[model samples]
Target chain A: MKFIIQRDRLVHSVQEVMKAVTSRTTIPILTGIKINTTTEGITLTGSDSDISIQSFIPAEEDGNEIVEVQTSGDIVLNARFFSEIVKKLPMDTVEIEVQTNFQTIIRSGKAEFNLNGLDPEEYPHLPIIEEANLFKLPTDLLKTLIRQTVFAVSTSETRPILTGVNLKVENDELTCIATDSHRLAMRTANIESKINGTYSVVIPGKSLNELSKILDDTNELIEIVITENQVLFKAKNLLFFSRLLEGNYPDTSRLIPTDSKTDVIVKTKELLQAIDRASLLAKENRNNVVKLLTHDGGVIEVSSNTPEVGKVVEEIVAEAIEGEELKISFSAKFVMDALKALEGTDIKISFTGAMRPFVICPLHDDRMLQLILPVRTY
Target chain B: MKFIIQRDRLVHSVQEVMKAVTSRTTIPILTGIKINTTTEGITLTGSDSDISIQSFIPAEEDGNEIVEVQTSGDIVLNARFFSEIVKKLPMDTVEIEVQTNFQTIIRSGKAEFNLNGLDPEEYPHLPIIEEANLFKLPTDLLKTLIRQTVFAVSTSETRPILTGVNLKVENDELTCIATDSHRLAMRTANIESKINGTYSVVIPGKSLNELSKILDDTNELIEIVITENQVLFKAKNLLFFSRLLEGNYPDTSRLIPTDSKTDVIVKTKELLQAIDRASLLAKENRNNVVKLLTHDGGVIEVSSNTPEVGKVVEEIVAEAIEGEELKISFSAKFVMDALKALEGTDIKISFTGAMRPFVICPLHDDRMLQLILPVRTY
Candidate 1:
């Protein structure tokens, strides 16, 4: 491949593709990024067996010449060193040329780098999915949906299926759910599509996280193509492919409570800060549990105690309280994560009892809810 | 102990003292911070065998009350947990009280934390250093002197004395020199003192690093007291104590060449960037060597070659070249570090041959100089 490309454009494309490149991959070729140059533009691809990402830079962008190609070819270079070199090159344009014996030369200003390249033909082929069941949504909305639920996915490998987020679409509404048995996060949004029947799939949480990081927070529409064993996300000049987890996701609707014995609406920031301070001492304990108690006059008490370290107690004034008074103990980290995900000024927390799971949602917003199981404390 | 202290003041003092506190200390009490409340102020101390740091928050500073003392006592609390709690406390004023059985209660706003405290008697006593031969220097100058030479200290423990910076005082001039046998960094500054004789000691690089971090960039005079085996630095409300390394430091004066076969003056920043880019590929090799060749014209070539990877060559414009043309290779990392430490718009580099050690100094300043040994390359 022989091409001269703008330094900034090459740096951005290399970074985007590197999201799928794993440093410790068992396959030697997977540690390298494949660069293919054609008459249209230059394409970079990176894969780690689970997911693959490809980024393209056209010859011209916005009436500005981005790349000048002299020949069409393909080669793979070590992603880590190549990315670092590209970032530190001291020139506006970088020239890359591929010679015989897989030798690649990169020149920028007075600095030139020659990196050993591997045969691109040995790299794994990307699986293609049909565009029949494609759905479109704003890139920002998809990023938000991933962020709101990805953290709740099970990090433990004991239950492999639970390590992925379940996506279900019905009647033009798409719902994303992630749970680790102790807590669950659910978010629903409307997507534009013409599917004739309901569609469901489970995507690995790690793939979603990497995708979200590479996706910009723009209003540009992203087309998502889904199949039985694979999924593809297409943006302006990026294509992301992820393998679907082969298993059935557990039904989590029953874990969320439909009625609440106690409900209180409080300013999110105040309650978050109070719980944060109360959890400082509890952090040294194994469970890191903090207790919340509702009292008369719209007062809430948050407390945690560790016999060897110390104990912390905090009293906060709630905006309003309804239903019966209650007390619940749960993981401080779980509650903090849920509160951080539910982006709003005010939040309403509902409790069924002291031992059952409770749900928290943004005030006046019914599209998203976070549920946490309480810990039994003597 | 009973006192109410401002949170910001407490946080700053705790951070300053934490530099001496190590989590993996064998002495249990050494891992805790000793908090002593007196009628005048509150004192916080942390020690880790090699060094001790104490910060005092007086009752008032600049006519603003920083501490309100209700009683006088002392207690030791776990440095790790206490620092975390103090950082996250949600109030401007924090109330601390010690009750029976070393139980400590810290109250701030509506939140309260009770932590288990150790008996103050178990904590080690601070060593007393006589202030007979005390010297004074600006805090900023001291910090700069430390930064200029500390990076050259040997990190390997094979020769323990090489891991320290040698400080020699003669004729009211304090000179600091550090070398790892391959390179040397020396910085000298004049100080006001009442001593009549010369004094010298080796201070651990780690201790100097920590001390410099806590010292702000102000012109405040710092009192430095030198003892036979210990050194004490006292600022307005802070006292830092460090033990001296017990060994003879090697003489580094012979390592810096007196004459040069080739001398070149170049912009510090431009040469630094060129070397940085040339080192990108060289970093993958074990030696990490970059070659510099001076041409008849005012041009210098910087390049590196790795057979398996590729090669990079760059020609840079030198401000002036007055000596014989020569070619030399050296560790890119060492050259970059020396360049980073030298502060000036231009630098003068003198080379005595292809193999002899060279010297680098600021264009017009003689306070600091860096010497580097060139690597022999085929």
Candidate 2:
């Protein structure tokens, strides 16, 4: 294989594909990124069985030359070293050629690198992406959905199913939910889907996070297709594939309280900052528990006490407060994450009682909701 | 004790003192910062036995009210908790009051923090500074001296004395030197001193690093005093004290070769980048060894090879090459650090032979010099 390509284009493509490469894998060849050159373009692929990313650099784009292919072949190079070399190459154009015994030579200006490459025939093939049953969603919206719910996923391995965000599509709406049995985050979006029936699948939170980093914050559409055990996200010239987690996700809909005895509306930024301060001394606790007390004059007090450290009390005026006054204790980190994820000037919190879980949502938008289980405090 | 102080000034002072506070300390009280207030101003201090930092915020500065001290008293608060609380407070002015039983109340806007304060009597006193014999140096100059020599200090604990930078003052000049046996860095600077004879001491590299962080990048003169066991650096309203290392420092003046058989003059940035690229594949080796081969007409090749990984070769044009052609290998990280620390566009490197230690110095200036022992290659 022999090809000359722009250094910048190659660097970006290498970085995008490198996101899927893992250093520790059962198959040693999987640690290397597969590079293939065709008359049309060159493709770079990195995968570790769980997730795969493929980036293609076209030969010509908008009449501008990006790659010149002298021959078409394939070779696999160590992703870790190749990525570093391509990024630090001296010139705008780089030449790559494969010799006998899989020795690949990369030349740029006065610098040359001879890298040991593996035979392409020994590498595994990429997942066969079936384009049937495709659903298109704007890139920014998909990123937002992932950001709002992914943080709530369980980091523990005891309950493996809770480590993924459950995605349910029904009636032209897409709902994303993640919970760690302590806190739950749910977001609904009106996706551009024409399918009739409901489709449900649990996508690992880690996969969504890596996919988010590769995606640009543009409003362009990204086509997503889910099979029995794999999901594929296809953009302009990029393909991302993630393996689905095996198991049934828990039903958390009934856990969210439908009615509340007390309701409060407060500025999101103000509440977030207050809890952040209260958590300073409370961080030693298991949950970093912070207590909230409601007053009659539309005022709420946030407080936390760590016996040996100290205590902190913060008062923030609520825009509106109704029903009976109540005192509740919850993890400050959970509430802060929810406040930051839901974008708005103000948020509404509805509480059923001190022990029951409470729900928080943006006052102006009803699409995103976060629920937190109150901790039992003495 | 009660005082209302500007939050910004307090925050800066807290950060300055926090540099000396460490969570892991033999003396438990050392983890707390001692705060003392007089009619004139308020003082904040943090000490970890090895080093101590004190910052004073006066009642008035340039006709501006920075602090209003209603009463005078002393208390010690947990540095970790107090620092976090002060940084996240909401108001421009913070009111601190000591109630009964060492219970302190810190209030800002509608937020209040009740912290447990220790007895100020238990906090260790700062080192007594002898100002009779003092040396003054510009903050920026001192920072430069530290940056050039500190990095060469030994990170290994086999020889504790080598972990410090030796300072020698004589004939109205201060010379600083540091070496890890394999490499050495020496820097000389002219000082404004009237003291007679020579004053030599070994300042711990870790202490100089922390002192460098506290100092501002200004030309203002700072008073430095070195005694038998302690060194004190006095800035505007800050006092930094560090314990000096014991035992005599090794004389490495003869390590730097006075003559050379091969000389090369090259742009600092060009050679640095070339070696960086070569080190990409060579990093698996203990020293990340990179070899330099000089050609007849001012061109040199920098290359590195790992049998299993690959090899990289870079050709760079030098401004000048004199004497016999030679091949030398050195650690890429050492050369890069020296290149980054020195302020120059072009540098001159002198090699005695392929195995002898080489000297590198800025072409236009002779105040700073670096020496590296070549690694033996098979």
Candidate 3:
């Protein structure tokens, strides 16, 4: 590819695409980033088998010439080294030229780099998805949805489907759910979509995390297109594609309790701090379990004990107490994750019994809920 | 031990002492921090055999009462867990009481912790160093001296003594030197020592790094006392002791060249950036060597080549050039480290020939010098 591009613009685009570059050299071609120059602009693509990211730099942006193309061609260069060089280049503009032998030369001010390029034809092509099943959502909302649920996904590979987050879209609501048996997190939001489609696609949690990092918090809308086996997210000048996990997601509707024997309202920050202190001792134990005891007059006690380490007990005043008094023991990590995902100041936690699973939701909202299985602490 | 201490004051002291606590529980006692309460105040100590750190929280400081002691006793508790709990406790004052069996109860507001503590007698004691061989220096100067040379010490355990930095104090000058055979760094500063005692000690680089982090940038004087097998540093209410390396440190005086045929002065920032860019390509090569060629009229060219990765060429204008033009190749990492340690904006580099070791020092001063050996790149 022969093109002259602005240093800042090229650096920004290269960084976004470089996230998908494969670190492992099992397939040597996968370690290189493919660059293509056309009449419209210059495109850079980086991909592994799981996900791919592409960024385009147009010839002109807002009356400022970003890229000037002399010929239409393509080449692949080492992604890691190329990105590092571009970031540290000491100039405002950079010139890139490819020779007939596929040798690429990048020059900026007094610095010049000559790289051995590979033919772009050797690189794998990105799968294209139809726009028929596309939806639009604000970037900030999408980021928030990913942050709330992605951490609850199973990290183990025993059940491959559980490693991905189940994304379901129907009617005018979009719901995202992630569970690892020990805990479950769910978030629901409204988006604009024309066609009525129910997508039960399980996207790998790791891939979703990478995509979230590339999405800025701007007010711009993102277009999401889902195919049978792949999903594509398109922003202003960036394209992100991730392969979907194959298999049926477990039915988690029954896992959440439908009734509660007792319910208590507590401040999120107060409960989080108490749990954090109790966890100091619980972390030494194998299960890392913390007990919550609710007494009369809005008083709740949090305690944890380890035979060899120590024992900790703390009390937090609940906002309101309802029904009979109760005591439950659960993983401190699960409770902490649920509390962090909650946006409201006050949270209502419902307990079925001491041994059964409990539900935690916002004080006034039922759209988002979290469930955690209690541990039997003797 | 029975004492009540301000939460903020106790937390600050505990953090400093916990630096010596061992992460590996091979020696169980070494992982616990010992707290001694007396009529004067409370003293916290943590040790891991190689290094020991003690922080004292007095009864009153600057017209504020920091501790209220009811009795005199001592106990040892798990350093990591105790520090974490104290930091997150929800109270301004913390009350600590020890039972006859060494069961420690720490209470803050509505939170209480019962820890299984060990007798302080079981913990190893720090060596008592006399003030006869003491020297004094500003905390800021001492910190700077440690940072300038400690990074060059050998990290490998093959030669135990090489992993330590050598310190030599004479009548009015103190010098610190560190080398891993491939490169060497030395820094010297003037200090106040009236006794005219000459001493040489090898302190572990890891301990020095931790000590440097705890030392603030202030004009307060730090006292250094050298015992037969240990070195003690006393600053403010903190006391740090480190075991000396047994074997003798190799002499590095001959490594620095006194005369040179070629010398060049360049802006520190410009040279640093050029070296960083050239290193990107050299990183793929075996030795990460970058070559510098000097031409007439203060023009210098930097380049690096990898057989498979490609080559990079960059130029930087030198502030001043003298003597004959020459070309030499050296590890980019060593050059970068040397440039970062320099205090002045402009650095002067001296070279004897293409194969001899070069010296990098600040333009106006010679208090610090870095020597790097060139790689024979054909």
- Judging by TM-score against the true structure, name the best candidate: 2
For each of the candidates, what fraction of the native contacts does it recover? 0.88, 0.94, 0.95
Q: Is candidate 1 or candidate 3 better by DockQ?
A: 3
Per-residue accuracy of model 1 over B1-378 as CA lDDT, tens digit each = 799999999999999999999999999999899999998999999999799999999998889999999999999999999999899888899999999999999999998899999999999998899988899999999999999999999999999999999999889999999999999999999997666688889999999999999998999999988899999999989999999999899877777788899999999998999898888878777769999999978999999988766777888889988788889999999999999999998999999899999899999988899999999995
DockQ of each: 0.76, 0.90, 0.86
Best by DockQ: 2
Model 1 misplaced stretches (Cα beyond 4 Å): B322-324
Off by over 4 Å in 3: none
Return the DockQ of model 1. 0.76
lDDT of each: 0.92, 0.93, 0.90
Order of models, best TM-score first: 2, 3, 1
Residue A3's lDDT in candidate 2: 97
Compute the lDDT for candidate 1: 0.92
Give the TM-score of chain A, superposed on the true chain A, for all candidates in the order listed.
0.98, 0.99, 0.98
lDDT of 1 at A178: 97
